[model samples]
Target: MLEAVGLSARESAVYQALLTRPGADAARIAGDCGLAEAEVGAVLLRLVQDGLVVQSGRPTRYEATAPDVALGKLIGRQEQRLSAARLEMQRLTQMFRDAGAPGDAGQVEVVSGASAVSARVNRVYEAAHRQVRAFDRPPYMQRLGENLPLQQRRQREGVAFRTIYSRDALALPGRFQQDIELSCASGEQARVRPSLPTKLIMADESMAVVPMAMGEAFAETAYVIRSSALLAALSALFEHEWSRGVPLVAGPRRSSEQLDQPDEKTRALLGLLAGGLTDEAIARALGWSARTTQRRIAALHKELGVSTRFQAGAAARDRGWL
Candidate 1:
């Protein structure tokens, strides 16, 4: 554990010994840590230089600094260095792509197998800084809601997420309420479309991951696209689909008394209606029975003064309800 923060095995052992027996001389530390006196003295000098230990008195007693303060600072510095390294890596990747030969295959890497594809997907999301744009559909590589916590953390860190879900994806049993709606409630900007050409995820306009196929083995192969014209085209494709998508908003839940009024659930109903979901799909998402769902639709139609469901959807949009 200490090794991750830049301490070697010997250094960690010496530090632990010092921490347990503060104000000990190098000889005592050596005996406690099972190291030679000379080695302990050298380690003590390095520790003092690193601010992990303080040496004082003629005989040179070494005292360990508070681990919370010292280790926390060390970990912070390591994180800064890692951040810098990531930036440099991006710079080098760009340079490499720019210098690629005519038919070089460096920009697009083929990641094989389900586990590899899933791991690459996670890495792409983890590395995103500014924004994440995705076209979400069925045949998921990982379990549903697996990335929810990570996405929420990124949102809290000010990273923006925009996802366009296919209508079929939203219509999956329990998917809308359990995953999509919950994500929208947690700061994800969501939209739904009747269908999507493909599933894709792009991070900060720098990288994208697209499955090679959408069959039963869709997760077995994927193309990890680095910075290139293809990546730019994929980003443009996302924008096009995003423009055509209907906004899917999940509002705060209201009391049953508020059901008579136009509320979030109503807006969600309008969105689902616009997305072309059937009555059953809508009912499942809103946790309502078929009868209740029809009653609500009837009431919505009456309120909107529209005889047809399509007209109701259009009217709601006209009135800015969806």
Candidate 2:
């Protein structure tokens, strides 16, 4: 801890000893701190020079300076140095990025094989500081729950996550309740689209990982995109898709008497419906049977005074239930 403030271990020990025994000669400090008299004298001289120790009296006894004043100054200096280093690091990073040749391999790296892609994905997520944007679809390299803990930990650490799931992705067995809803509960801002053109994960506009193929070949090969025009375009595309996607809300199911005041269940139903999920997919997601799902949809439509699904969705949106 003291070293963090720029004190060596020997200096810290000597200073602590002096603090405990004010106006102690070098011999006394040496005995108390288990150092030789000569070593203690050298340390005391350095400490006095650094204003961490004061020497007085003809015998040259030493007293530790007030820790609050001394250590506070040291900490402040260390912080300044660290801030300067961070600025230099950022400058160097920008230079490195700019040094990449146009259409060079550095701009976009191709990683092949499922294991390599998985490693790259994890690395990208770990590097995310501010935000993570992802397009979730089928043909996953890892299992459904594999990335949940990582995502949750990042969210807890103030990293924002936005994911848009394809309908097919949510249609996976137990995916909706087990993975999607659980993620939403852990502070992930989730949305769903009927389909996605590709699978992508972008971290803080600095880097992105995109699968080269969909379906069976997904994740067999991936492109790791660094800071480039293509990355910016990809980010813009995500924004466009996100603007059109329907949000997924996770909350406890409750009963509501009025249609205008829909409960969590109704809101979820509306979201799934508006996201273009099939009746069977919605049933699977909500843990309802096909018949029950259809019945609820019909009731929702009647309550909203709409005959068709589209009209019901529009009415729900107007009522602020979606």
lDDT per residue for candidate 2 within 1-322, as digits (tens), equals 6999999999999999888899999999999999999999999999999899999999898899999999998999999999999999989855654433234434889999989999888876677878899999987778878999988887887899999999988777778777887887678888888899999998887888998877698779999998888998999999999999888766544456554477767777887888888999999888899999999999998899999889987888787676
Error of 1 at 35 (Å): 24
Stretches of model 2 off by over 4 angstroms after superposition: 92-109, 113-134, 141-164, 171-191, 201-208, 215-217, 224-265, 278-311
Cα lDDT of model 1 by residue, 1-322, tens digit? 8999999999899999988898899899898888899998888888888999998999779899999999999999999999999999979855653432223333898999989988888767766778899999997767778899988988997889999999888877777777888888888998889999999988886778899998888889999887788888998999999999988867556577655446777877887888888899889877889999999999989989999988987887787567
Weakest 10 consecutive residues, lDDT, candidate 2? 97-106
Q: What is the lDDT of candidate 1?
A: 0.84
lDDT of 2: 0.85
RMSD in angstroms between candidate 1 and the native structure over all alpha carbons:
6.3
